[model samples]
Target: MHLREVRSNQFKLLLIALLIILCMALAYRLLIVRKNLKIAQQADELQEQKSHLLEQQMALDSLSRQLKVAQQDNQEELRQKQSEYNQKAQEVELLKQQYIQQRQYLLRESTIYKKIQKSVSTPNPDHKELLTDKDWKAIYKCIDTMYPSLSERLVLAGITPTEKKYCYLSFFQLDSKLEAFLLNVNIDTPYKNRTRIRQKLKITGSEEKLYEHLALWG
Candidate 1:
């Protein structure tokens, strides 16, 4: 009986030892599982951060592209404006050239311009007029009062007048200047030149001209 009781006690001890070992192994497995789960959660969080970074990079690239495109568009607009300005400047230059050419042509084609170019001394002096001494006195008085400065500058040419219904007179210095001021005279586009041409006068020289006036003999 004693031997049998000893064996029973030994068996109980062995069972307790087995149960402790089993509990230790189960706790170790639980700790390993918890560690693995924590590692997985950390890895997931890292992946999410990497994805966010990638999205930001893409957005930045898109914005950069947009800015580059905008710069190109602005440069194109500036080029267009420059082209338009250049074209307009060229047109204005062309128009100015045309106007100058036209004005020069018209001046060359004028009859007075031809006469000024070809005139010589004593341009057709034997012209006739109808005037009395009273008319001459009246003209002298007008010249003195209306053009006092001119009277001081120019000498009046002497003219012989009679009741013979025709007379001729010559002018002294700056003769043609008086033609524009003559109002009470009838000229048939034929009158004696008061001064000679080609005496450093006419357009090619000092811009002087020879004009004639014809009065009806009454």
Candidate 2:
């Protein structure tokens, strides 16, 4: 009986030892599962953070490219405006030069015209002695028949009689005024032909002096 009692107590101790070992194994397996789950969750969170950072980096790069493009456009626009301004300035300078040349040309033309007018309008003293009575009567008759309206004008100018030498008729223009009349009692033909006489009589005072002489004689 003593031996049996000892065996029974040993059996009870062994069973308790086995139960403790089993419980320890189960606790270790549960702890291992919980650790693996925590590691997986941390890995997922890290991946999400990496994706967000990458998206932010891409957005910043796009914005930088746009800024560069805008700056380049502004620079090109400024250059174009500067070029236009320079072209206008050159045109203005050219116009000013043209105006100056035109003004100078006009002044030169005006001076030449004034000199021509002065030369044509001056009277000759030598032509006064060539008139005569017969010449006057012939000129008066011719004027009355050809240009009656000029009689008053001719009378207003001075005319005198002298010895008759020759008789003639001529048509002439003086300062754009036309004269058609008979010229009487001249020593020599002052002009060789009709064209020459016309050209000579174009002298400014010739028409006025001739009219005056004819009026005095009449």
Highest lDDT: give the candidate number: 2
Q: What is the per-residue lDDT of model 2 for residues 147-201, given as tens digits with 9 covering 90 to 100?
A: 3344454334321121111112222222222111122214233333333433333
* Per-candidate total of colliding backbone pairs: 2, 5
lDDT of each: 0.41, 0.42
Model 2 ranges with Cα > 4 A deviation: 73-218
Lowest lDDT sum, 10 consecutive residues, model 1, at: 209-218
**Candidate 2 collision pairs:** 132-162, 157-212, 158-212, 159-213, 166-185
C-alpha RMSD for every candidate: 52.8, 57.2
For model 1, residues 1-218, the per-residue Cα lDDT tens digits are: 99999999999999999999999999999988886576456445534544454465565555555555555678776565555555555655565455434433433443333333343232434332223366556444422322233332222322222211122222211233333123123442123332232221221433433211211000
